[model samples]
Target: MTVTLAADSGRLPEYPMELDSAQSQRVERLLAGTVISLHDHPIRLPDPLTAETWKLHSGQSADVFGGDAIVRSGLNVVLASALAEPDQRRLLSWAAAMRPQLLGPELSGAESLALAMRGEGSAVLLALEDLGSIGTDLVGIEELYRAGFRSAGLVYNTGNALGGGLGQSTDGGLTEPGRRAVAMLNDLHMLVDLSHVGDRTSIEAAALSTAPVVISHAGARSLWPSARMKPDDVLRAVADTGGVIGIEAAPGSTRVSADTTHDLDAVMAHVEYVAELVGVDHVGLGPDTFFGDHTQLYSAAGWSPQPVPGYERLALPDYVAGMENPAEAPRNAASWLVRRGWSDADIAKVLGANAARVLESVLR
Candidate 1:
């Protein structure tokens, strides 16, 4: 178990619990007597990550979503992915003040997992988008970690000094400053997110980072090729770094609205492709599905199913029938895994085990 993928081998890391037999026992034993978690149960319940997963599933907002809903999601931990740099101070302050309990990155693996197993409290992992809040200073990232920040993405839908995004005309890959920034991230033990980065950036980052990184929320382009989804090579690179590819529920990636259809099968197809491409261990659930109207929300966020250079004919479909939102999407995904005949142990990994393993590797 000493050998890890290490950005060169294109395999999972050499952690002991990575073994299905071992990790499954650890998770099952941890939740021995707990109310059989229903988020994974056939009867769908709530999840506490992005929104009040239940309500988010039901389409309720301005209510309890985001950090406030994590505890309700039956998860012991949640990552607040890509908070606004400008509003980060205020956002972090509010997160620190939430009742019911909001632990930071200071807890031990045993402590956090134990609390989660009991469904008692939750630990919030902070993720950042840009370095603008720190005036482009790489060392300033350490201050961010001290402020409870633990993970970050170098770009959003657009590129920056670090590298390119999906929309980049010509991806220059990781610049010198971007390399420094990555080094700083490893020094502080922060998990690098490759979801929104360009292919070159994602590939270079996977090789550059010593610690395993994550494509926290994305889909397989091989299923339905798109600029936003990760290609097989990039996916393999992430796998090599011992990282995980979280399946997203974004419109272009999962469903197309122009076609009236239930896209649950389409979404599952991406998961299946990842598992088949790089073993079940490399794949996990990262449904970036929305809580509200897909069209309204995605459009407002400037997301359109425009045809990329090669993917010109592909347009966004109108079907909202698949894994629609957070509340039930994970459950729906689990159901697919079960139908595919995945073992309970591998299903556990996709649900949260792999994510947990990566978190422990960096922040433990």
Candidate 2:
């Protein structure tokens, strides 16, 4: 039950999770196939010494993915807007200059898996969390793709030139440029993620894309009624396009009831709801976890959930029990499904096959 540190001595520290016999067996079975996290922030962690600056470290142990079968892929943010840097333009410029060097080589999801199978390293599909890094240029998409990003979310939490995000007071939907972005992404064979996009924008982008579009990390609003959660129609839109809705498990985002603490059950409830609404083939896990105290990270970065009417006073948890970080989410998710009597085929689809199918179809 002791988790080892990253292979490199300079990596960030990791904690261990104690699993009983049954739990260990379930995890073993879960790792029997290809597992893909639709969305996550693997590198972002809270600064232990001071909240004022980020603890950007390079250490990622084998536990980060639990097993070789699990592919760590999704949104990788260079600079999350939550940190509130005073000079945005300067940071963006620096990020653009350093991004190519930062991402050494381009590796497709399939290639990453091949490396893992050979025991070289964990499979990872690099993706940009938002297109904001590109600013106003459509060519930036191609640049980023060449820089090794296989997928990208159009907007963060607010309106950008591309589209409106969940944080906007009124969604203006996808603009002409947004439409172009969608088409460009589809043409380039990069995965389009709508997890943080506004409802209208998500629908429009999903419909416009020839390729399958994913809500990489979000939950069913019918179950939780949070603005951050996606509605039935939006879920249908993505599924109808042959895409998947990876359930969100970040703190209070997927709570099923008035429970003060968010746990694996709450996350699974969202999964079950999405499955029933759009079938199991269109669902997966995108816990959106990282390597630190997420709630504290949120507070330190001045980020808070967008309050919805009548649910404005929602109580958020410090961490999601059994899914506190990237290392724990996939194992716990697969174990939950196994405990719930899901067939191995169905579990495999949810774990990675479905997302891999989408990746294979789109990733160049």
Q: For candidate 1, write residues 318-340 as lDDT tens digits.
A: 43344555444554555556556
Q: What's the C-alpha lDDT at position 150 in model 1?
A: 70
Winning model by TM-score: 2
Error at 59, model 2, angstroms = 18
Candidate 1 regions with alpha-carbon error over 4 angstroms: 1-73, 83-114, 117-119, 129-135, 255-262, 301-322
Give the alpha-carbon lDDT of every model.
Answer: 0.60, 0.69
TM-score of each: 0.72, 0.80
Superposed by TM-score, candidate 2 places the C-alpha of residue 90 at a distance from the truth, in angstroms, of 7.8
Q: Where does candidate 1 have its weakest 10-residue lDDT segment?
A: 1-10
